[model samples]
Target chain A: MKTLLMTISRDLKVAYRNPADVINPLVFFVIVISLFPLGISPSADVLVGIAPGVIWVAALLSCLLSFELMFRSDYEDGSLEQMTFGSGPFILVIMGKIVSHWIMTGLPLALLSPLLGMMLFVPPPGLTALMLSLLLATPTLSLLGSVGAGLTVGLRKGGVLVAILVLPLFVPVLILATAMVQTGIQGGDYTGHMLWLGALLAIATGISPLATSAAVRISLSH
Target chain B: MLNVRNLTCIRDERVLFENLSFSLGAGEALRVEGSNGTGKTTLLRILAGLYEDYEGEVDWALDEFPLYVGHKPGVKDLLTATENLTWLSALQEGQVAPDAVRAALAQVNLRGFEDVSCGSMSEGQRKRVNLARLYLTRASAWILDEPFSAIDVSGIAALEERMNDHVLAGGLLLLITHQQLQLDCAVRSLRLGV
Candidate 1:
């Protein structure tokens, strides 16, 4: 447990030292959402109708933008190799990394989402639903995205490959999240959508670390 | 003791080495010498369990994990020397105190640079920060891929003395290097790509 905490703290320090890494994704999220208002109609009806999908999609893309940072530096600097042989379990290391990545990208994105949703003229009732869905769903995003990050870590231009591999898997979460917000917009009960998102998060939390650890081994062999 | 039997590695449809065997024991230092692209790093990595695509039996008779210092050195540019070593030691489950890490950095001629970020340091300085692990590691075996590169003449001499001391103290050492080792201990030589 101490070792896992150390890994998490170490990763946090690394991420903190590079402020741009933490800020860029958030900026991308805001910019992408802002562009939707300008590119599409700025009126409340059109914006409210499309608000949930817009916020969710922007958040997803921004999260993807930061996945490259997950394991690339560690792999390049030989830290990942040492990690495999370290006394701590490899799964612990994977878990620590995923946790930190979510803290840096997913958590902040989820928090910033309501402001963006309001800017898009989403109904007041839907704003809470938007934040709640993102809170549950972005963790799943980080979890699933980590496997892709681990697999393509060795490639020179892995960002695109990560998107190609991970975006398809993101469909379920997207559908569930957007649905939750749409129900909230109509002042309908969103408990089912939240339950489904929570279930996906639980499933993703269970599986992603194992898959990522294996992916790291495979990437190291290359 | 470390034993290898019929260790063969093939990469990109080319056989780097086939049917090779060797054993290393306590109080031994083996220097792996080879030209570029001879799979010296590959063999070291295989023994370190970082690569497993090869066919071989690498039986490690010791209990502790080997301290592997690879070509990349594993030093992060954004972290201070102390932070890097603290994090690395924690990774290895050693958990050396901050003061001891500072002492190791001093031993590597990085006395006052412990708090300085590695990015601002020179290549040799960064390498010394990485080499500081040698002073703190308690592992029974050390697998180093070129521990002397980018080091000055005195640094190389100091490191050689330390390597000899480690071997003479009953620790095993396997290193890949092009420089002729000038140590007092018996240095075994393995010429790859013959």
Candidate 2:
């Protein structure tokens, strides 16, 4: 437990000192969100119709933008290997990293989504739903992305490979989260969608750290 | 407290080393000497359990994991020297006090620069920040790959003296280096790519 907290705090400290890393993805999220109304159509009807998907896709892409921050530096500098050989279970180290990655990228993006939803003309109910769905779903993005990041940490040009490997897994959360927002916009109960998203988060929280550790071990092997 | 037998590593379908074997007990230093691409680092990684694509038995009889300082040195550029040491020591479950971390940084000749972020330090200074772990380690064995590279003459002498003290106190040392040892203890050398 101490090891886990220490690793999380260490990563947080590093991320805090490097503010650019934390801020860049949020900037990407905002830019991507704003570009939709400009590029597609500025009409309120069209903008409101596409707001949930636009916000969710932007959030996913922004999370994707920050995946490199999770393990690349640690892998390059050999800290990941040292953590693997540490006294604590390697999964705890991975969990700490995943948590910190979410804190840096996922949490902030979720917090910033409501504003983007409003800009895109999403209704109040939909904006609330957008925020809630992101809060529950973005961690899954970070969790699942960690596996891809770990698998490709040793490779150059791993960003494309990680996107290819991880985006397919993200399809379910994207579908469910978008549905939840649409249902809210329609004044319908979206509790079922929320339950499914919750279950995905639970399973991802249960499994991703272990899978990431295995992938990391494979990459670390010479 | 370390043992290996019939260790053969084949990388990229080329045999780097085959049918190699060695062992080290407490109070011994083994220097892995070889030219570049001769698999010295590979051998160290295999022993350190960072590399697993090999056919052999490498065993540590001790309960504690060996302290390994590899080529990358694991220093984070955004972190201060003290922060790096504190977290690195925490990886091994070592509850290093703030004063001890300061002392370790000082021992590495980073006394006044302890709070400086590693990104702003020289390469040698950054390397020294990683080497500072030597002062705070609790493990019985040390596996160092090119520990002297990028370090100054006085820093190298300080490290040599520290290694001498470690081995004399019955700690095991497995190192890969090109520098000749000036330690008081007997040094065993192993050449790879033979």
Candidate 3:
């Protein structure tokens, strides 16, 4: 737990020191969210109806955009190698990275979802549900995205490849999160969708870190 | 103390080395001398427990892990020299005192550059930053792959002196270097011919 916290703190420090890293994803989220209103129907009702999916998709893409930067920089600089050979298990190191990634990218996206959703004309009640569902679901995104990030850490042009590899895995989260918001908007009980989101988060948290460590080991071997 | 017997390494369908055997007792130094492409780095990796494709038995009589420093200095370009050392110290399970880190950097003639981003430093300077890490960790064994590739003459002498001190303090050193290193110690040289 101490090593995990240290890794997370190191990552957070790195993230905070680099302004462009934080701003790029936030800008991407805003720009992607803004496009929906201009490209889709101008009717407020139609825009509000589609806001949940739009916000979720934007958040997913933003998270995916930041995932490549998670392990690649450390791997290239040899910190990843040090962690692998260090006292702690590599999976624990990976878990720390995932937690830091959530704190930096996922948590910020969750916090900003309401404003992004509002831009799409999402009503207040649905915006609340969207934020709640994203809060539960984005850590799962960070965890699963880390596996792809680890697998492609050493490859040239790994960023686009990571997006291609991880975005498909996010479909269930996207569907369930948006469904929860839509159900809330329709005055229906959203407990079932929230429950499914929680299950996905649980499963992802349980399995992805170990898989990511294996993938990182393989990548380093080559 | 460290022991390795029957170590083999294979890379890219080519056997780099096979049936390699060596051991180092406390306060002993082993220098791996080899031509280019002779698998010195790969052997170092195997010894450092980073590569497991080889068949070998390794035993150590120490509580600390062996420190491996590869050709790359492993310092992040964006981080200041101090931050780099701090993160490395944390990863290695050592408490890195700022004063100690600063002293190490000054010993390497990198004073006043601790707050500078490593990307701005010269190649020799970057190598110095990596050498400073040796002063920060208390690992019993050091596996250094090409530790003197781009360092200046003065830096090389300082590094040799540091290695000599480490050996004097009952530390084991496994170094892969192309250039000849002058040191006063019980040195064992292993040459790999391709």
Candidate 4:
């Protein structure tokens, strides 16, 4: 527990030291969502109908944009190698890093969802649903993204490969999140949607750390 | 004791090394030497448990985890030198006080540069910051990959003294380096590619 906390705090310190790292994804989220109104349709009705899917997809892409850097610095500077042979289990340190990274990037993106939803003309009732779905769903993306990041940490051009490897895995959460917000916008029961998103989050929390650890070890082989 | 038998590593349709074996007991140092692309670093990494796609066995008997210092400094660019050492060393053993980090930096001759970010430091300085961990731990075994490379003449000499002291103090040293060192202990050499 001490080791995990130390790792989490250390990662937080590192993330904070470079404010751009924490802010880049948020900027991407805003810019991408902002562009939707410019490029697609400015009609509030069309925007309202597509708001949930647009916001969720934009969040997913912004999260993906930040995934490559998640472990790239550690892998480059050899910190990952040290942690692998360190006393604490490598999986736990990875989990700690992921959680702290989410706190930096995912949490804020979720918090900003309401304003982005309002810009998209989403109903006021769906604002809470958007925030809640993003809160539960982005961490799942981070968890799933870690596996792709770890697998490609050693590759020369890992950015595109990470998206290819991880975006397919993100479809279920995107669907469930959009479904919940759409249902909320329609004044229908969305309890089942939250339950499904919760189930996905639970499973991702359970398996991703282990998969990421194994992927990191395997990356050293190539 | 650290023992290996018939280790073989093949990377991308090319055999880096095969049919290799060696052993190290307490109070000993093993120097891995080879030409470029001959698997010296690969062997050291195998010893350090960083890479594990080989067909062999690594049997180590130690009280705690071993230390591995690789080619890169492992210091975060956004973190100050002191912060990098204090935190990275914590992953190995908990409760790494700030004083220990300072002491380790001093041992590596990096006293005044503690607060500076690693991104701005020179290559040799960054390497020194990484080497400070050697002063921070009491681990039984050390696996260093090219510990002497990218270091200055005096830095190399100081590191030799540290290696001698570690082995003399009964700690095992498994390292890869092209620059030979003068040590006051039994030093074993393994030359890959025959």
Candidate 5:
């Protein structure tokens, strides 16, 4: 646990030191949300109807953009190799990375979703639930995206390939996340959606890191 | 403290090397000399436990883990030298003291540059920062691929001194270097043919 915390803290420090990396994804999120307003009618009803999908998609893409840098930079610089040889299990190291990525990308997206949600004319009651759903959902995206990022870490053009590999896996997440928001919007009890989201988070937290570590080992091989 | 028996490495439908066997104990080093196309780095990777595709068994009795420094320095370009070292230390063991990082950097002649971002440093300077880990960690085995390539004369001499000290202190060193490396300790040479 100590090692995990230290790794996460270090990653956070690195992410913080480079403000542009953090700002770029946030900008992407805002820009993507703005496009929907221009592309569709400005009617509050239509915008509110589609806001859930738009926010989820933007969040997914933003997470994907940051995922590639997670292990690729470490792998290229030999830090990943050292971690593999270190006393800690490689999976644990990957988990720490996933968690740090969530704190860096997912947490911010969740916090910013409320403002974006307001812009999309989502009902005030639904806005809180939308933020909650994003809070639970984006971390799962980071974890799942990590597996794809690890698999493609060493490839020359792995950026878009990572998106291609991960988006299919994200379909279920997209379905459940938007459903949760849509449920809240429709004045339905969101407990079931929240429960399902929690289950997905649990499954992702349990399985993704181990799979990512294995994929990373394979990718690092010449 | 290290033993390998009949190591065979095959990649891309071609046998890079076959039936290779060697061992290194305390006070000894292995210099894997080979032609350009030969798999010196690949062999080093297999020995370092990073690549398991090769057919071989590497047995080590050392308490501490082996440190593998590849061609790339592996320092994050965006991170300062101190930050990189601290993070690497945490990943390997736990939190390392600031003094230890400072001492290691000074050993590699990077005293004042510890706060500088690695991206702005010269290639040789960056290599020195990477090599500083050897001084910081108590790893018993060091597997370095081409440690001297692209380094200046002073850097090479400093690295050779560190390698000698490591061997003298009962640590093992395995290096792949084309440049002539002069050391006080006995070195076992394994030359590969194209």
Candidate 6:
């Protein structure tokens, strides 16, 4: 637990020191959302209809943007090597990283959903579903993205490759999270949609760190 | 103690080294010498358990785990020197007191640079920060790759002295370096790509 917490504190410390890293994805999230209403239509009916899909997609992309550097610096500077060879199970440090990644990118984005939902003209119920769905889905995003990031840590233009690898996996979450908001907008029960997202999260949390460790071991092999 | 038998590594379909074997007991130092791209770093990674695609039997018996420092210093640019050491040592499950960390920094001639961000330090100073970790490590074996490549004469001498002390204290080390380490202990040299 100490190793896990130290990794969390260290990852967050590094992220906190770099202002651009913390702010860029968030700015991207807001900019993408604001541009949707302008590019498509200013009509509230159209905006409200497309808002959940647009918001969820934007959040996924922003999370991916931050995920690119999750293991890059550590790999480049040999921290990953040391972390792998360290005393305790290195998998725990990886688990710590996933948590910190969520705290940095996922938590803030979820907090901002209310404001983003307002701009999208989403109703109160939809906004509630939006926040809850984001809260559930972002952990999965961070987890799945970590696997992609670990696989492409050494590749040139790895960010694009990670997106390509992870987007397919994200499809189910997108479908289910957007379905939650849509159901809420129509005053229908959305509990089923959330349960689906929760199941995805549970599976993702169980498997991603181990897959990432294997991918990292592959990349480390000469 | 560290033992390796019949280790062969092939990288990118090219054989870097094969039929390699060596061992080091407590308080002994083995210096791995090789040309660039000759798998000096690869050999260290394999021993460190970071690489798995090798034909070998590595039987290592020790109390604390091995501390592996590679070509890179593993220091984060945004973190200060003290923060980096604290966390790095924490990886070993050794909570060296703050005063002890300060003393380690002083031992490495980095006394006044603890609070400074590692990004702003000179190359030698950065190397010094990594060497300071030596004072904080509690591992039974040290696996260092190219530990003497980018440092000053005095820094190298300090490092050699530390190695001698470690050996005299019955620690084990497997180091890779082109520069000869003059230590007053049992020294073994192994060349790769033969």
Q: Would you list the C-alpha lDDT of every candidate in the order shown? A: 0.91, 0.91, 0.85, 0.88, 0.86, 0.87
Error of 5 at B32 (Å): 1.0
Q: How many angstroms is residue B147 displaced in model 1 relative to the true structure, after the best TM-score fit?
A: 0.3
lDDT, candidate 4, at B32: 84
Please list all clashing residue pairs in model 3, or write none if there are none. Answer: none
Off by over 4 Å in 5: none
DockQ of each: 0.72, 0.77, 0.57, 0.76, 0.69, 0.75
**Model 2 pairs in collision:** none
**Index of the highest-DockQ prediction:** 2
Model 4: per-residue Cα lDDT over B129-181, one tens digit each = 98888988878899888888889998998998998999999999988888867
| Tens-digit lDDT string for candidate 1 (B61-109) | 9777899988886888889999988888768854678888989899899
Clashing residue pairs in candidate 6 (N, C-alpha, C atoms within 3 angstroms): none
* Docking model 4 quality class: medium
Candidate 5 chain B: worst-modelled 10 consecutive residues by lDDT? B86-95
| Per-residue lDDT of model 2, residues A85-151, tens digit only | 6788889989999999999999998899889989988889988899999999999999999999999
Whole-model lDDT, model 5: 0.86
Model 3 Cα lDDT, one tens digit per residue, A124-163: 8888898899899999999999999999998988988998
Chain A accuracy as TM-score for every candidate: 0.98, 0.98, 0.97, 0.97, 0.97, 0.98
Candidate 4's TM-score: 0.96
Q: Tell me which of candidates 1 and 5 scores higher on lDDT.
A: 1
Q: Model 3's A-chain: what TM-score?
A: 0.97
Task: Please report, as a value between 0 and 1, the fraction of native contacts recovered by candidate 2.
Answer: 0.79
**lDDT of candidate 5 at residue A192, scale 0 to 100:** 89
Q: Show where candidate 4 strays beyond 4 Å.
A: B12-14
